[model samples]
Target: MAKVNGKYETIFIVNPNLGEEAIAAIVEKFKTLIEKNGTVESVDDWGKRRMAYEINDLREGYYTLIQFESAPTFPAELDRIYKITDGVMRSIIISRD
Candidate 1:
């Protein structure tokens, strides 16, 4: 498939400490927000797994994969929001092209 020049794919890792419902809610919120302004190719949850290293003292986390279409400039804003989110251990957004 042809991806727009400004489009991107974002994959963020959420903390595993959140209950199942909370995890679901967070993922759904992301799906809703991303789909509202752009296109979402997929949203995948890899479940809990051990991390390579500790993050905020966390050794494991709920691994989630998200593939969405977005503008070039949108990632920074998204990153900023994710950085402040409590249950988000770490998040990174990369261009899918």
Candidate 2:
């Protein structure tokens, strides 16, 4: 089968209630997941930041940005993972290519 790899950027916010250790673990989990399914180019941890609006009655979150190259079909799986994770507050995946 042919690989249809494309560049993608994902920005996700995790609940601020989580401890630093837990937050780091979550970031690592996603990094590994992306690297395993694709190629991780960069990971930028923006740390905690104020949200523009409230979500789940929370006003702040830990932000992370990951740039990667992956097969076209892989994003849906990533999105699904993000949705099911307990601490994730919001996320977005966009094609950079």
Model 1 has an lDDT value of: 0.79
Model 2 global lDDT (CA atoms, 0 to 1)? 0.96
The sequence of per-residue lDDT tens digits that candidate 1 reaches over residues 56-86 is 8989888778787776666777788788877
Expressed as tens digits, the lDDT of each residue in 1-97 for candidate 2 is 7878999999999998999988999999999999999999999999999999999999899999999999999999999999999899999999999
Provide the TM-score for each candidate, comma-separated.
0.85, 0.97
RMSD, model 1, all Cα superposed?
3.3
Task: Return the clash pairs for model 2, or none.
Answer: none
Specify the poorest-scoring 10-residue window by lDDT in model 1.
1-10
Pairs that clash in candidate 1? none
> Residue 32, candidate 1: how far off, in angstroms?
1.2
